[model samples]
Target: MTNWLLRASAAGLYFFSAFSFAADDSHEQFKQAERIAWSGNYEAFQQAVAGLDHPLKPYVEMAFYKRHPRLRYETEIDHFLTIYEHTPLEWPVRDSWLSYLKRHNKKARFINYYRDTSDAELKCTYLTYQLDLGALKKPILEQVADLWTVGKSQPKACDRLFSMWSKAGYRTPELVWQRVTNAAQRGQTSLLDYLAKLLPKKEAYLAELYQEVRRDPSSAAGLYRFKQRSAKESEIAVYGVRRLIWRDPELALKAWQKMQAMFTFSKQQKDSVAYRFALALASKGHEEARFWLNKVPHERQDAKLLQWLMSNMLKEQDWEGIAVLFTGRDNLSHGQKYWLAYSYAKRGELDKANTLWREVAVERDYYGFLAAARVGVPIALNSEPLQVPQTLLNKVSQAPGFKRAKALYELERYTDARREWNYLTNTSSDDEKLAASVLAAELDWYDSTIFTLAQIGAWDYVDLRFPMAFKDLFIRYSERNRVDLAWSIAIARRESSFAPDARSSADAYGLMQLLPSTAAYVNNRNKVSKKRLFQPATNIRLGTNYLEYLKRKNEGNEILATASYNAGYHRIKRWLPDEAMPAELWIELIPYTETRDYVKNVMAYRQVYHTKLGRDGNILAAVLDMKIAK
Candidate 1:
């Protein structure tokens, strides 16, 4: 046994040495292939990759895949597709190519390729495309449905199924009604009724459906029908009155009293009842709408209901009510905290505002920053530079009017902060500019202040006082960073479209939407007095510098960097890792629907700027298309 063990160990060592040498050789070969591929030599690229094996082959193939549709080397599409479909390349590349095929109406090819594609997201996308392209019918629908139904409880699958069916125009009211009923059985009656109305001809059958369901009330279908019928004002009143009286006597009394006072109660009466009931309860300080809400039946809380409630809450400044609704709900992303904090602050509840701000600040939330700035509370800036939260940055950067300018200033991106201030001052009436002069003087930006005053050629727009100073230094600094000039101009365009003095609830200050901390950072870096950050040049320079930093940090991954510019680098980085290749690919794969759209816009903007400047239009494209370093 001892002798056998020794022999085995020796053989294992020899095999390991051989494997290591082979791996080294394969890696060298892969690099050679990559070099040839990059040079546009498709034949050599193909030959080099073919000579490789296993893991090395996959990477080499990926490199070639990325540079497909070679202008010079016209490889047969079939060969490319065959290799992509059968090879062990990464999913992102495979999925990208498959999507490309689908886009070009390569239906037969897509169908064949999709059969071998196992990635669920890719498969769903392909199937959805098939349905969209009109190549799919009921038979295909059934197959997709069966696959989805295997895990019906999973929300993603259900959503995909719904999306697929909806896109196919399969208006199965019965199925919608059935789902609604099922939801009701699980105490999700509200969800059930919401889905019920989505069915075509639902209103015509609603009454009969409700009567039948109410009589039986055994299945989800029955409950859905009952809720659909009960969604009416008269029905809701009857149900609400009973439920409120039993579950919440106070709210019931309020609803009953409001309903009884209505002179004409018909189809419109029900809408009025719902509206008035909510108003009356709110007026009576019945903060919790639980009792009356329960009486509303499931189906009535559709998109319409949700919109109505949210709209009212916003318009009426019902902070307490909104707080009740959103509290402990994961459905509300951190983005919602700003509005919540604003509502609380409006009510003069400092403690609540501070608490919520703290919660928001922890996540570097965008709205939270505005809320904090609005409330005039001191928020500790995260020490790490260029790591501010994206949500806050995006909100501030996108803020409209003078409020946007203010947000930039408050965030301490003095250069941009001041540009917005100057814009407001320049565009404002003489009296308004005069009021703002003191603000400019405080930041030591007298030149911007004076120039703005001079530019009020015919002050036609409303303006306010600028109390911060530092204008001269700001302009000087701005000249130092041409990129800031471009960025400031771009930001101005994006925010109020250079309307200057643009204001928004986001509290973004100036042209560049610099947060207070960012402005301060610029102030410190330039050795300009901190007070001067609000000067137009200072704000512009700082804002531009920050934007440039983002561009550099993402290695010219403009989309990621732009989102970082608008949102924040930390937030964008959080979506991906520090790895070069995956990071670039992941930026293209960002899931945040907003950021994804933002990247395209920013890249398009960059390209436009490149063209405007008479530089190569493809320069930015080359920057974007560069291979991620390993």
Candidate 2:
């Protein structure tokens, strides 16, 4: 209760500690009202907010509208919107008003209050309203056509609109056929049968044949048996080739050879089919990948294709192949340049490798550390101090969004506070952003502190970006579990941004995001009886112990332990290579996108947190040069 009511009083002092008690009490009252409002006690909420003279008064007024029976109060809703018009409050109020109108079928009022928004369901509803009012037929029909052409089914709100258009004859046979084709291409085959009923007889027969070829991609050989070919046949061939290639590239390649002789596909379709099939082979580490690679024209190579090609070469240690593949390419990234230099060194070209390493050694990333180690140069991942202006700080402290954010922060609504903070940061100047970052840090808002500082894209203010908040708790737990303090900090930052009550959709609780079952098991095993796991000290204690257990189980590999923590231990064990490899490449090959990103970020953040703790941040010694345990 104190944490909730004290934030508003504290932030008031944060901006101006010299204010009188009456001003401070009003702020505290609004904070109390916010809590009551969310508790669904309308009478108590109203009484608490009555006669409040604080910056949060607007939020208090809006809270009355929030708790009010929504559709029963249109006049009041309109009055609310008019009072808050052209402000942030107006948009949220309008969104609520629009939802009320949508529920009550108030068509004219819905359109009258509508604002341009990106919500798919809202846009669909608006279009439905336009159709209901008997507006211009051509515009409405065009939108209908656009919606019907999508591969996946839309929200249930869109079904009525689609049914109306279909019944009114706007859904022609050609249009339905086109939609069926689009559905098949995007792998939404469940939509095909319903779409087939709308097509002409001959095209409907073709749709069945398309589905057959699609269901069993290996049956693509049957496509060549047709005496005549059309655009439909061409599409089916490409679809079959794309799907079958992943299953068996050898079979797909044979089908492609026959497809070339048929001359059914256009040049662009042919290029795409060839590029996809080749990479499918390369990703599987098949030697036949080279055959398909030779067939693809240089212009057809995309970023993903090039990455898989390089990954395959690196897997085989084909250094000459890598050199031949990337020589004289001017768009190489820092990581690519380092790998290219490594390839040159592997091929016994020391002079060429050293020249490239000199440039790569200056980067502030993982490869830079590796390159620095190679060249005996100092790592360039050094922090710089922020140069903020005083005037910008003053201006930001007065911004409306900041006031709302401070208000919400006091109420323990971190999610709502973050929304206001984002609104402020989007339109802020660089110095104002720096000031906001500092303010977030002062408020113990670790997530916003980390995010806002990163938005500035300046690395010098390491202290502000990576504050060692909860130092005694984190240090005590880390030492007890025999875990590195930097690693503990990194996990805490990535897991919850140090939001002690943070939760995920998976039902994980607290800063370390431990699942309920995991927390219970840890408690039972450790003979601890703390019921509230959200407290910072207890969460850190359990999280550090769990991470340490994972580290030992993975043979002292931080990469593997972090990966297992994100993706389960059993799943990570299945991902290990046959032999030891560089942790960098090992991380890239991780199949789970979420786990892969988690590992890299935790490792990188460990370096940042280490540097913030005034330790020598050696990236090479930390991760790059070491082997990820198999």
Candidate 3:
């Protein structure tokens, strides 16, 4: 027999021969190998893992040593690579090996094994490696040019490579201009300033001209400041027109009329500027915006233009206008097609509505459920349970990358931890992917656990899908405020995905995603003392009280209460109509993309939670029963 089989057989026999161990079998013994490895029992781990006939053997071996900070030698990592070349552990081990070499200044060793063609940081390291060997010239300069042309600043690891390029006089005016143009399109003013300093004194005037247009588009509204015209001037005119429209669309229209008579802009530039103004005004629900939008040739119209045009029509209840927007479009999304059908229904065209609804009702989602309700069809989840192999489960449980992922989560570096967890899922077998998902849940990686299962198409595990994390707190606060317990669970699932430590860039915190100001008001009203708003019990209490207040304001419509919870109550009130309309249509027409989707997702989660809790009847039926408050 080969060496590997001998080791496997030896491992299988070790437990039986060694002692009267507490575990039942080899699988159970291998489970403890991971704990022993993390407990800093490297030698003991090796001994135990050797007596284990499981796929976790190699993973447990590498995981213990990867977390230790003192193992810096190149030869030591090289030994690891040799043993695990073709195994499932190769990528993580190799990635960490490269990181160790880079962090410790082992340049020669990094170059020897480095071939990461995709990561820009490692590519800069490649240039540094070539510079060290004195084999630099044309190729190195080409890479420097590529890196410097990006619209945003390159990562700081490129500092050395960029300095070398500057010393060699390869940084040219042409390359700087490209980067400036890219930065201008992206509104990256800081990057534009940095690139401007690299320009020659004569060409530096161009950057100042671009800045003037950016700062105040009204100055060039009539194009009366210039005696001459060039391509640069034409581009500046386009930008100025867009800015003028943003500040005052009515005045922008007047300026556009005068500029057309006074200046000659290329057809492409004129179309570009007109579309920008039209789309902006349409977003704000300007009455005359579509008159300008219709002037753009049908061939030039795109998805964004169509969406904003539809939004304006929906706000006006001009069903014919909505139909006209999609008449010639061939690339309509499922959502768009569903909305088109709804428009036809409002126009009393039942045949067309039925045809469209039939196509959309087969999938599972907010729209699909609504479509199903409209056409009297059952919602189709079409999800299947995953069958994981026992061996792959062992690999997932003991991989070094997973250990790193868990450690990062503990530190509250959620983004970094997500990337590490991704390494564990990237190439895992289907069953192993499910096992990784369970591992995430076990670690209370709420978002990762939920999203990972969705990632792998394993959607039937409702318990995993709708986790009962912090149920006691949800029940306590929800009942105290008379908020439906299911609504509280639904809000938490959508807001933070049951992550107690979740936070948004807006400083919204915890299970309910309450902003500090909102949390403070809730606390003051309840006479509770100030504490961490992200703490589970406190956040739930504040959030539920906020929900109760909204429900009272909206006449007990959970749909409007939920929408108010995401968007402020005042905004939801402003969105209310003079006449009653179906609540689903009201949600579909809401302008803010984030708030619209927030309402849809939370309501959908409400359905899932209700179904999982053994409630019967159509969930969307109750949601649609809501009427717009007059």
Candidate 4:
């Protein structure tokens, strides 16, 4: 056995298998050792994993620690955690090891091993450990109060800590009111009631009023009762008004008008109310939207407010309004610059518009493409390939974390693989991240490649950012559905980044992110099962066919079809203008920010894919040629 181990070690074999010494066979043995560890056979688990030099050896050791969990293995646990500090292996083992130390009353070791955590029990124990060591400082007491003042009841382990903090006068009436407000906001009624008892008899009534206003924001109409104009009173009124605005904007406006007359609201408070009220009014298409929006100074208008105002202006063809909104603003985003240039052109300031368009066209985004088309400039890809040193690339690829990530990916444990990959990228330097993206691309893990580049803001690496994945599938489906090939590929890329196993929180599945219902609706003649929806061919085919259906339904307009694909056809009908508009104008007026951005990205990505596919496509020609009818 010793001689055999020597030969296997010399040959770089990770595990010995009876069947064969292939990589797959070694993986199987590693898996088998994990199962044996779970079965509580420590000696057999050890022997099974013996001579293993694979990247997954740490995982096997973690499994053994779970089953054994003896303090005698502390040295090995420390070594595992130190070697795998940023990887997923560190947390579970460290958590369990801390628990073991806590249970054994090993306070010194616990303090040594403890890292900052949000776990209330661990935090309480950590503070208690400090208190036992004569740490009654204001900072320690303050941390104890932070844990104590939360809305919900903490674990029983916090009881002793709370007693100490209260004795130290850290739990004052002011802190009690703060907790009361938190509990009320979080709808922890019982906790709020308990906290109210901690206040003086006169101020306790404020807690009852808070509960009343929380339960029925309409109670804010009785503004006369709040005569003190205290900070707490203002908080209650603002909370009620904010909640009320979402329910009934007009009523919220009336209540705020009355509250402002009675209370001394600061400028920030007034602006906060104005911002929410403006958004609510604009979203509901209230006539008073413009009035409320103007109440907010231009400096305070964020992207959402700007988008809403721009949508309204585009609908009204108020080019001067759009121009005025962006004029003299040096900090405009690319989209804002495009709109500003369009406004200038519409209002006959051709020189200014052309100059701005020239600047905007240099970018590689939706607005950049549109600006380029407007000014008749060549659309720039701005491709700067990520160039990493061969030595660094080789070193990164051979890192233990990268090796384990690749191994997990090869074993089809994608979730685990993605976790490991994310950890690797998050902790790597910029060059290391670029190199990691190259490694991910080589492994055909396009999602990680795209996300890592995005994380490092390496947008000029267009090839890495927009990989040509599943080219044949996209082409075949595009032809089958009579859809534009680049368009279909762009949609899939935007939806899933070509991760076939992608599933969204909305239960959207696979490469195209099709909700099962939509897939069934499109393929009513032959239902594609949920399982097949994840397959690249089926997802592309179904998604493209659905896009085609939307196109034909929208009078063969691809822009409308793309919008309907994201925001539903029913919403598209509601959003349609009574008068005909340019397709770009109509697209800008889309109410849902998500749908609007989706359309813009899809259009831009389609153009990028077109160039990537070696086609002589003009990005501007596509946008300028389209029009939407009433």
Candidate 5:
């Protein structure tokens, strides 16, 4: 009996194992079928689906059919309609479906579905469809009534509906005005009377609205009312006088003095009025602006006015006054601190400048470099060798604006750099590959650039930008012009980092940072439209032409021309009369440190690019032969 029971148990275990294996096989088949469907192998996917039985068959079929192309108009329309009917659509996809439906002339169908559906999004979509169909006025009126009915039960939806109604040009409705009055009572006045027209019968609402306006005169609606009234009216005159007190204090005093007999006020009100009186006196060059500002209650003091006072102090180089403002509760932003540091540096307070620089450098914020550079301090973190943080390096590599290959090179991760360079050189234009080749040569890696360039057939992408497009163009241009290609590369790198859309603070645009006026002149001379100057080929053409023009103007002095390109030709020409100096010395002696540093950095970068091209030594020889000073 025991042997028979054991046999029975073993038999059951075997059966269970077999069933589990079969289930596993089915799951694997489903996964493979899904893969096939995703790859658009419809025939294989359909066969896989057919092989599935019962419940799995429907599931697999649905998955496969969801991806099927809707070639026929009926199929496309029916597919979306069915999906919309059955599924709760997400915002992004629902928006797409709505657009598709509208484009296909199914607006009525969409509106019907939207109204019947209980979903908030659906109702919103319906209202939008109604608006789009130019049947907004009726629906907007209905929505206002719905808001009153529902009250706070669906405030968000009501708000959205009200905003839509306002946007659709129904803001002047009596119902809307009533709703605005209600909203204002509840302190939700932001939307009230926004673009609302004033009704002729204003006496009923004016007193309440005026009180709210007095509480916050900065409100646009209040300002509009004050402007609309005649100057002789006491209330209008008082409101306008108060506005002018802050904005144009001198005018406010004149208006207030003229209306002295119009009204009586309490002692507190009279004292509260003293602040503006002092401001007006100060505006007329009286020292009382400071006197009143000091006497004003701390709680009542205007932060904006204080900030303005600090700004004026800074403009006057009042270091002690700036320090006083800095010590206030409102700590300055990094940018503000940087400005302060600049002021300190100009005052010859190196210790203070260094302290500010240290604070900025440690933050590793976007403005750190600019701040540190302004203070003549090298941006360092904890006395450590400046290494790009791995997180930052990874982020920069993935950034669309930065060239990954160049960024990798900068990070000194050479193997990965070579891989990216290989990819860019292999798949892009000849000029680009040539540039890659130059980079490879600098790393002592040969043939990769040539092979990649050839593989990509880089010449097909070339236009007037020539060398700017390809590494080979640089070599050719350099040889033809008898100038160092390395130097040109350096300048280009500093100007744009090779981004075609690079723009400067001075309104210089494109890869070479050409000023709009300069670009316009170049475009006109070339008979190219002003708009075309932003295009890569056009910008490069004009940029190089301008560069060449500057080179010639500076008597073939590359350094001087490069400086003139950055700091303006007129400024450089005016400064050149001091003495004929080597380019390096001239760069070092440049009055504007920005231009001076620009020349040095460009020269240094030229050598770096040359080294990357495996022509570093050769380029150095060529640069030396020019006998260029400084």
Candidate 6:
């Protein structure tokens, strides 16, 4: 590696106490060769590293081929790519080779080697090559149509192919109108204007008006303009009303009532409007929700709508409504089952409720654990170990792809490292994938390990799936904060899968995913400080303190505290029931899907962590004893 790569890699490795590179002359030689490689002296770069045997030698080859414009040495480049096929090393060489083939008009080989990609230019090139070779077919034309009809402008390379496709009558005014609508939906007003010019005068007018409706959905409230009530005009009305409902449900409802008189909406269009209006009313607790929800036909009641209906009923304390909503549904999630059981129990039907609870208690999850507590049975983890022998693990770990991935990760080329890791997980054998997950866990790449296992549905390997990452720090901070150690650890695990430098889109950092502002507040409040929020120790300490604060803020109710931790405490306060309600019912009624799922996963993971740490594992029993109240 070059000095920059070496220094960067060293800095990354410094974070892990268990990892260290050997201080040897071979390292110096590699660095010297890498410097030459980057300096554009390919011959000297090769000579410098000729005698070396290193895990990162492929990187030097990659540097050369990536910069080499021509594919003069195809065999050598092919060998390198084949050896590092799924590794990050394949990226530059493959791209270079593909570019060379396109430039040279190597149509057959380009088509042969071409994998599907999202790059419009590359796709255009590929299709143009196919057109040149007389491989035109319906599917090919369909692909060309798809490419041309996208909302945004395609690359200049696509112009020739699009012109040919248009000459062949594949480009219709209908497709242009579709593109106009697509552009409007994507907020590409310029593209919409460009597309509208391709349509007839009347169609262009409709297209422009649709764009106007997109810009301001309430513009459709001028029902006089839609007196034509054409299918296209009705489509614009339906589209406008659906969006308007979310912004102002009462007005949308009034407009929708008027629209039914002016427009002839198809069954699908009416159902779409009803779906949107019903969900909007139910979500906003509008007085008209029950009416709108009932307007939706039974066959049109999808899972999401049913869930919202149940939630609306629960908020109204209509247990009979909830019971009715779940009737005839064959597939109920454990959470759904728990709520259904609660509904039945509230309606004085203990037999049906217990039966459903027993069914749910047989599984493992937040609902399963809580149902188990209700039914007086042991929560079933069904924890089964993946039976990969050490020999298989050793063999798979020795693969060159895994080595390159590890090397890239250690060098802190996170994007490239993730690409290589994802390739392995996606393409490997069942045994190999499981073994690689085990290796990933051993390498302390907990995020990759956790997700890889999930990708392969390998939930049975609880030990590998849930490693005790940063346990010492967790214990220290949890004790200091007087929080449950397992709960704290579980929170970290759910937040980031123990990735010490994890960051969320919300700008929460480190294993515990604390916002920097929150971390600073906790630091100032505690008279302690850490400049780096990404550091595992500082994040854990601050996160545990925040958890303790949430617990206290919620009056020592862990369930509410957990919910408050995911959602804000103020939101949790608003979500609290007016009268005391069962914990299951309250959790079911949490409006935000993210916080609802977050609370459930944290609770379930905490229970598992308790058993893993040899601590008391009855967190759910205490949770069941508690009630949610104002």
Best prediction by TM-score? 4
Better of 1 and 6 by lDDT: 6
Off by over 4 Å in 5: 1-108, 111-125, 128-198, 202-311, 328-332, 339-353, 361-520, 529-535, 544-630
TM-score, ranked from best to worst: 4, 6, 2, 3, 5, 1
| Model 6: lDDT to the true structure | 0.80
Q: List per-prediction Cα lDDT, in the order shown.
A: 0.48, 0.75, 0.73, 0.82, 0.50, 0.80
TM-score for candidate 3, please give it.
0.75
> TM per model?
0.26, 0.81, 0.75, 0.90, 0.37, 0.88
Angstrom error of the Cα, residue 280, model 2: value is 3.9
Tens digits of per-residue lDDT for model 1 on 1-630?
Answer: 123224534554221122223444545665677678667667787787777653334445556665564323224444555564433333445465566665676765666556544455556655665666676478657655433423123335246655666688664654555554444334444444555466465453543343333333322121223333333424434443443443454656655565555423565555444544554453233545434443454446553344335434653456777676566656555545655665677688878867886676543223333334444543322322111133332332232324434434444444555655655554555645543443333333434444554465422111211111233343355466544333334343443333234344665566455666666665564354434543456556776677666777887655556677666778766666344543223433354545654654444333333333334423332332454432
Worst 10 residues of 4 by lDDT: 12-21
Question: In model 2, what are the clashing residue pairs, if there are any?
Answer: 384-460
Better of 3 and 6 by TM-score: 6
Q: Which portions of model 4 show Cα errors greater than 4 Å? A: 1-22, 132-139, 208-219, 222-229, 523-533
Report the lDDT tens digits of candidate 5 across residue range 468-520: 33356455655655556666555655786554555678777765678777866
Q: Per-residue CA lDDT of candidate 3, range 1-630, in tens?
A: 223224445665221122122334644665588678778765786687778765345656666656542354346556767876644456566766667778988788778877556567878887887787776577776777887788787778888889888889887777788887777766677777887788776566566667667777776664655445655666666777888887888878887787776668888878887788878777666777878788777767787777677777777788898887776678677678888998999999999998998888876678777788889887666544434444654567667667556555554656657766776788676777788876565556777878888887777766667777788898899899999888889999999888777788898888788888887676774443333776888889889999998899888888888888988888888888788887877887676777888998887777667765567755886655777756
Ranking by lDDT: 4, 6, 2, 3, 5, 1
The residue-by-residue lDDT of candidate 4 on 425-472, one tens digit each, is 888899999888876776678899999999988889888788888888
Q: How do the residues 426-469 of candidate 6 rate in per-residue lDDT, one tens digit apiece?
A: 77887888888867866788889899889878887787777888
Question: Can you give the lDDT of residue 232 in candidate 6?
Answer: 79
Q: Using lDDT as the measure, which candidate wins?
A: 4
